[model samples]
Target: MRVLAIIVLALIGSAGAEAREAQEGRADLKHEILKRLHDPNAARRRDALLMLGTFTDVPLSPILHSATDDPDPGVRAAAIMALGHASHASNAQELIPTLLRALKDSHPLVRRAAAGVLGRVRDPRAVRALQEAARDRDAAVRAAAVEALGEQGDQAALTTLLERLRDKDPFVRRQAARAIGRLRAPTALAALLERLVREEDVDVKRAIAWALGEIGNPHAAETLRTLSRSTDPYLSATAREALKRLISDATARSRRR
Candidate 1:
């Protein structure tokens, strides 16, 4: 009994010491970041924002929020991303407004970062802002916004996502197809089918096929069957796998019925 008590005490002491050391380390890191954030060099300030992203435990929201307005677009973008890392379910709603504003930043990089982070936060309030961003001039920004809208999982954004399927940028079109797949809206089947036939980009076609499979509507089976025989190995394999999922899902539904 004495030996067991001694072992428990030793462990408790060791854990206490480790916790104190971690706390001190976080304090030191916070100080360093705060000092660099005010430095004259924009690069240093940006690097500080990136470092701040790595430590979410520090009380750094005020500093990060202010950094979002930094003259340097790169620093502003980094600050937006750091805010995303600092956010959790409890505080995500509070951060949505900042991200929404960033989504409209003049710099495409800042807008793209905001869209990406808004998606990660997955707040319903951001849906409208993200929808607008989906029409951004920059293809990358549009793609990121489309992806974020899918992440929001609000069916209300489905119309916007479907429209993006016809975006001139093949990458945006691919992202739109993927976002639609994530939503798994059966109503999107016809649009996806139409896009699949017209899409010249193999990657976009593959995404359409994957979306069809994800929707799991039996109506898509015929199209998937044709795609399953494509000479392109990745598309063919994806189609075959999608067919399997459709079969599995349909079988499960029938059993439940």
Candidate 2:
């Protein structure tokens, strides 16, 4: 099959590129780099997919688009990963449909890679997909999806993330909290501040404190200032530092106003 051949060639090319990445022979084989994206060898295909990500990104848009749908999971994962490295908006757009499809791939790695790449693409349509992924059965996939949603920084997914902060798994809760920090939603302030006050887990509490500081609300500023005066040294120290940053930020805003 032509698809099989493409996969093979791609694998071989990828291997060759890996071998030649720092070598003079492969460095000059620019033409071969373009050929690898369509290589039929699955192994070669994987190599080419990786190289294309580092090589001809903008010009290889059409190829990256096609690579995302490769029948081989390895190829699909590599292509999706490569798409994340593409700097051109147009090139990134062409891969969106494929990345979206990867979200549902039977292969967990494909789903994970797709989730991460979607974050890099920053398309609004990906918000829903990432939200769905946040609930995936696999912890790694769920975390990746949560991270992707945070990367998009879309307000639409804020409620979903807020709910995730209570995920049964501590890893998921930690990631959700970290992602909330990335999102810095004002609506998230109440929950994060509450978590800061109530969470017994040191790491989660630290994340909550950081999230409040990131949101930069004066409401949080007041609470953090209050926490600074508490007997628990760690919480007090974190709250005090956060309060300082918030105060400095507020002063800057006031001067600008």
Best by lDDT: 1
Query: What residue runs in model 1 are displaced by over 4 Å at the alpha carbon?
Result: 1-15, 121-124
lDDT values of the candidates?
0.92, 0.80
> Can you write out model 1's per-residue Cα lDDT over 1-257, one digit (the tens) per residue?
99999999999999999999999988987898889999999999999999888886678689889999999999999999888887789888888878888988999999999999989776667888899999999999999999998888889999999999999999999999999999999999999999888889999989998988899999999999999999999999999999999999999999999
lDDT agreement of model 1 with the native:
0.92
TM-score of each: 0.92, 0.74
- Residue pairs whose backbone atoms clash in candidate 1: none
RMSD of each: 1.9, 11.5
